[model samples]
Target: MDDTEILSSSEQKMEDASTESPADAIAVTHSSDDSGDSDSDSEDEAESNHQIETLESELSANPYNYDAYVQYIKLLRKTANLEKLRQARKAMSAIFPLSPSLWLEWAKDEASLASSDNVPEIVKLYERGLSDYQVCSLVYWKQLLE
Candidate 1:
């Protein structure tokens, strides 16, 4: 009939259905799930952070290591650290002009996250990307049109 009544009814049903009290059952379930999830998530974050640090050090040591830059970019993208991703892209672009495919991928990422407020920024990115090419690129132009 009301919140308390409904909760009591539900707890009654749960009590009838199992040997454990409803609160105890919920507590056990949540404790197990929360601990397991947090442990795995922290481990994953640590590992990803470690990888990112290693990649950053490698890039620092050899600024011209294109493969390392690519790996760092990919890792940052995978982790969804957008600010760091932007920095990585900028660093890589400064060291070596991004390939057409790389530019397209970067544009796609920006486009996916673009809001009305950020659309102009994305447009600027596209323009910069296009200007990087020695010749006009139809693929990039089509993407911009879309």
Candidate 2:
């Protein structure tokens, strides 16, 4: 057989063999790569905490630092620090009427963690968002229904 034909035939045979008994061709892998990264995770947490502290100080110095509030909120969200996230959002809302999009994001985040106890709080947030804009937000309405 020509080289091309030979290679094609071998490949076909391998495919057929695998298809005949897929279980035999399956691999069971155990990776230890993630197990060694605990130290790195701690280091990252420390770095994020330092950044949060710095941002907090900036906000304290000038509560009108809009960018700092945004960054702080983003970092808190990334860390899934719910209490801190709530406080950050509250602080920002106090300083500026939160945009519809920000309200939507905050509502969604809270909804994801919502329980029966906090349903009223979520509805209040949606109502507040709807009131913030001169025009009604269809997205907010849709999410509120959901």
Candidate 3:
């Protein structure tokens, strides 16, 4: 199709040139992943999440910063990553005890996952929702009720 696509394909096949370009080539090589079709890459899922994790790690290493807390919560809400969400919930509950939204979202996500999986875990999730997130709207309550 496009000349750019042909060149990239040729380069990957080691037929374009023996020497590599310095700057954009490095970025492409690092980011393209094994799929070759960088546009459809899934590797960024971990890297994007790692950016949030790195922020939390940095925050843990430093003194308290409210802005960092906000960013952490934003990432927690944005990411579908259960492990990172768990860590963020724990950290938020410890550092910002008054933020009910963090706990509510965490409970909601748990209940959502439980419902999707249709596992026995939903019972525990319902109980957690009751205790930790009583302020969710009627829709969430109805979901948990079922």
Which candidate comes out best when scored by lDDT?
Answer: 1
Instruction: Return whichever of 1 and 2 wins on TM-score.
Output: 2
Backbone collisions counted per model: 0, 0, 0
lDDT of 1 by residue, 1-146 (tens): 77798668557734542443223434544554555356754675689899999998998899999999988887676556778888989989987989887888788777777777988888888887888886788888999888
Q: How high a TM-score does candidate 1 get? A: 0.68
Candidate 3 lDDT score relative to the true structure: 0.56
Candidate 3 local lDDT, 62-122, one digit each (tens): 6367677667665554444456556665665565543444444555556555545655565
User: What is the C-alpha local distance difference test score of candidate 2?
Assistant: 0.74
Residue 89 of model 3, lDDT score: 59
Please give the lDDT score at residue 93 for candidate 2: 91
Query: In terms of TM-score, how similar is model 3 to the real structure?
Result: 0.46
Local distance difference test, each candidate? 0.75, 0.74, 0.56
Q: Which prediction has more favorable lDDT, 1 or 3?
A: 1
Q: Between candidates 2 and 3, which one is better according to lDDT?
A: 2
* Candidates, ranked, lDDT: 1, 2, 3
Q: Which stretches of candidate 1 lie over 4 Å from their true place?
A: 1-38
Better of 2 and 3 by TM-score: 2
